[model samples]
Target: MSLLAARDLAVARGGLRAVEGVSFTLDAGQALILRGPNGIGKTTLLRTLAGLQAPVAGEVAGDDIAYAGHADGLKPALTVAENLHFWSAIFGGPPIDAALSAMNLTELARRPAHALSAGQKRRLGLARLIVTGRKVWLLDEPTVSLDAASVALFADMLRGHLGQGGAALIATHIELGLDAQVLDLTPYRATIRPPTSRPAGFNEAFA
Candidate 1:
């Protein structure tokens, strides 16, 4: 069975429908990339799948999903190791040693999150996926702020995840050199329509 599946999914942005009629399935040991121009609702779609927001229509099935968005989601006062440990505890995941090593964070284990560079912080955020112990990953622009070498490191980690029977749905512009399928959101773009009610302050422009 697919680890995660979306059927006739319709997601909105800034209170307006952005993409619709989307359907896809991700299975063990597989990865799928979301492709489209900006303002096409890639982030909005991911947010919907991650359960951060509700979809306008259709359905998303399956669970055990971990989502990493543009924000690092780190606590500035915490050290790298502490952040990983905290996430692991919350997710009932494995120890931090492996995740630290995978993200090349072993050397910065003791450094506070606020002290790290942007790329380092991004890596730390991505590392949380390792500790989540979830079977499916939904990532949006995960490579942002990552240097080329760091991007390679992330690609290796993603490969490891899939090789171990985990699945991923990623929205990224750069190529990660992974053997994965691509799902273009262009054809799913919604036409102009009256605005729909969204959360009090949500805006798709920044999503």
Candidate 2:
């Protein structure tokens, strides 16, 4: 079976349909990049895929996919290391020491998340991707607020995930360096359509 597949997906926000009849299939070890302008349905799509947001229609098929969204999804009161430990506990996964070191966050591990800069929070949020031990990932703007070095580290970790046969659905304007296949939602939309109409049955229409 495909590692990730969104069949007849439909999502909306405040009466706005962000994604309608959107569908895609991803094989194991592959990654797909979801690109569109801000406020478009990138985050919504990622959230739906992650099971964080209920889809107005359609469903996502995959294993236990880990998700990291636009929100840092961190508790500022906790230390970076503590944040990682919290996620690991939730997922019943192992420690993320290596991932932290890869991002050069070892030094700041003990600092409260609130004390970290925006970039640091983003890096801390991504650490869960490494420790989740899941096969699929749903990332929304995974590199936001990151410095160049941190961005590079994010890219490197993506390479590692792909190399390990993981699949990802990344919704971000930033490039992730995975040489990911672009999944543009633009063509699926049209000025004439209301964005609510179900896409004519999937038959390679968007492939």
Best by lDDT: 1
Candidate 2 has its poorest 10 consecutive residues by lDDT at 198-207
TM-score of each: 0.93, 0.86
- Against the true structure, candidate 1 reaches a TM-score of 0.93
| lDDT tens readout by residue for model 1, 72-187 | 78999999999999999999999999999999999999999999999999999999999999999999999999999999999999999999999999999999999999999999
Which ten contiguous residues of candidate 1 have the minimum total lDDT? 198-207
- lDDT per model vs. reference: 0.94, 0.80
Clashes of 1: 1
Error of 2 at 89 (Å): 0.8
